[model samples]
Target: MSIAGQAVGLFAVTNVDDLLVLALFFGRGSDRRATWAVVAGQYLGFALILAAAVAAAFGASFLPSGVLPYLGLLPLALGVRAAVQAWRHPVDDEQPAERGGPRVLEVAAVTFANGGDNIGVYVPVFATAGPAGTTGYVAVFLVLVAVWLAAGRHLATRPAIARTLSRWGHVLLPLVLLGLGLAILLEGGAFGW
Candidate 1:
């Protein structure tokens, strides 16, 4: 796939968690700044994790041959889990305000908290994508992050949307996670798992 396509796919898979976090963290502030801070922190955290994976690969391969697909499956599983949760326990009308400022540190913490699966998947992608593919890969990832931030900002501003999302957010998570995980698993296998 082209860089654009890859980024879109990755972003779509990863955006759910970011969206959820943003909803959870919705507070009175500049949505634009908060979005950038959160999204940038996430992408930066992902990049760092990829770097660490590269370093580890140089010494001992942490991911097995079949690991990439499994990593991809994470999102699918998470999505399903969220959906189930939502079905079982619906969201309440009252939504809590976000607790922190757009401090770089806070953003980084939120990013890290939400980036576990992203980092896991990145390990394989970084290990596999050679020098020729790195630029495109990075580009795609960044664009996706930017797009996600934009969407998140919009969502943050819309109280009705936020309320609705919160009411069904738990349910949505599981389905989205499951789909993303399955897509990654399949894509990895098709490409060369």
Candidate 2:
């Protein structure tokens, strides 16, 4: 995989950190459930994007050439932002809360927020993966779903662990995002400035 390809993968997979954040801040149960729910949505979203990429790869025309690179910047910025935020705040390491909001919307928003980096990274992946990209893309989605599911369970059961994960997210997520941003800017043809 190219650097951008790796960036996209990192973006999608790195939300383990975010899960940690949600777990720590919200204290599992509602938070944990909410995070996982969002992850489920993320899986669907990524799958759709991957499918589109596959279709494009197979010569089914859809978005323009100029569009993908700009899209790349979105994830680049998102990753960097998440990482920086994590580093700045770190995890509070608190007890879980009994209260949480509706599962679907919370999950969807977070999933969408988390997806910024993935989208940026995936543009290149789609182009590179070619027509058979679905297999690899599917593999990515499955791994993500499994990871979030496990993490969500862990957070729900063990609030402390959730806190620990958030602290790590705070420290590591930003660095990953920053690196991804630089990588995207350098490698993605979409960025001319």
Best by lDDT: 1
User: Model 1 off-target regions past 4 Å?
Assistant: 26-28, 31-40, 53-100, 161-193
* lDDT by residue for model 1 (1-193), tens: 7756875677578557676555433432446675566666656655654554555444565644455455554455445644665567554557533322344544444454345456555556666776556556666776666666667767866878665544554544455456555666666673454
Per-candidate TM vs. native?
A: 0.54, 0.47
Q: Can you give the lDDT of residue 26 in candidate 2?
A: 36
Worst 10 residues of 2 by lDDT: 95-104
With a 3 Å backbone cut-off (N, CA, C), the pairs that clash in candidate 2 are: 27-96, 38-107, 75-116, 75-117, 79-177, 83-173, 83-174, 84-174, 86-170, 87-170
Q: What's the CA error at residue 132 for candidate 2, in Å?
A: 1.1
lDDT of each: 0.55, 0.50
Per-residue lDDT of 101-149 in model 2, one digit per residue for the tens? 3244433434443444455455566677653564666565656666665
> Model 2 segments beyond 4 Å from truth?
1-16, 21-39, 48-97, 159-193
- Least lDDT summed over 10 consecutive residues: which range in candidate 1? 96-105
